[model samples]
Target: MEYVPVWIAIGLVIGVVGKLAMPGRDPGGFIVTILLGIAGALLAGFACRAADIGGDGGLAIHGAAAVGAAVLLILYRLVMWSRTR
Candidate 1:
C-alpha cells in the first residue's frame, strides 16, 4: 500500500548494490536484478511486519532489505549456474 513506493526506491538502490556485490553474468540482466531486489524488499518488509523486528520505517529495515537482496542475488546466481550444468 503506502510502502510500495519506498520499496521500489529501496529496491533500485539495493539492486544496483547487488550488481556490484555479485560480479558475473546476470542471466536475466539488470531487469532481473531489479526484480530480485524488489522481491527482496517485499520479503523483508513482510518478515519485519510479522516479526515486529523494527517498528515502522527505519535504517534497520533498509539493512535487512540489503541482506535479503544479497541473499536472493546469490540464490539467483546459483540457480542460473546450476541450470547450465
Candidate 2:
C-alpha cells in the first residue's frame, strides 16, 4: 500500500483536531467535520506556501492552518444561524 503524503496526513490530522477544538452546535455530521478538517489542511498548505512560511518543520504553520479552518467553519455556522433566525 502506498503511504499518504506527509502533507495530506498532516492536513487530515489538523482537520480532525481543529474540529474537535471548536465547541458548539455545528451543522452537518462526521463527514462534514472530516471535510472541514481536510479543507483546513489544504487551505493551510496553500497559505503557508503562498506566504513562504512553510518548510521549517514548525508546528506554527500547521496550527495556524487548523485555526484558520476552524475560524472559517465557525463563521459558516454563524452565518447559517443568522439566516435561519
Candidate 3:
C-alpha cells in the first residue's frame, strides 16, 4: 500500500548509489537497476531476519541493504566478465 512508493524511492536511491559505487558498463538499464536495488534490500532484510540481527528498522539495516545492492552489482559484473572470456 503506502509503503510501495517508499520502497520504490529507496530502490531508486540504492540503485543510483550502486551504479556510482561500481562505475563502468553493465547489463540492463534503469528498470534493472531498480529491480536490483529492491532485490538487494529484500535479501538484506531476509538475512537480518534469519540472523536475528536487528529489528525492522535501523541504520544497520539500511547500510546492509546498500552494501547488499553493491555486492549484487559487483557479482553481476564479475559473472558477465567471466562469461565474455
**Candidate 3 residue-wise lDDT at 63:** 67
What TM-score does candidate 2 get on C-alpha atoms? 0.62
Model 3, residue 65: displacement in angstroms?
A: 1.1
Clashes of each: 0, 1, 0
Top candidate (TM-score): 1
Arranged by lDDT with the best first, the candidates are: 1, 3, 2
How well does each candidate superpose onto the true structure, as a TM-score? 0.79, 0.62, 0.69
The model with the greater TM-score, 2 or 3, is: 3
lDDT of 2 by residue, 1-85 (tens): 1212444566567556656776556566556766766676667666776687746646667666667666656666677679777
lDDT of each: 0.77, 0.62, 0.66
The worst-scoring run of ten residues by lDDT in candidate 2 lies at: 1-10
Query: Of models 1 and 2, which has the larger lDDT?
Result: 1
Candidate 2 wrong stretches, greater than 4 Å: 1-27
Residue 51 local lDDT, model 2: 84
Residues 16-35 of candidate 3 have per-residue lDDT tens digits of: 77767766666666667768
**Model 1, range 1-85, lDDT digits (tens) per residue?**
4666676678778888877777777578888898998888878866876788767867777677667767787788889989988
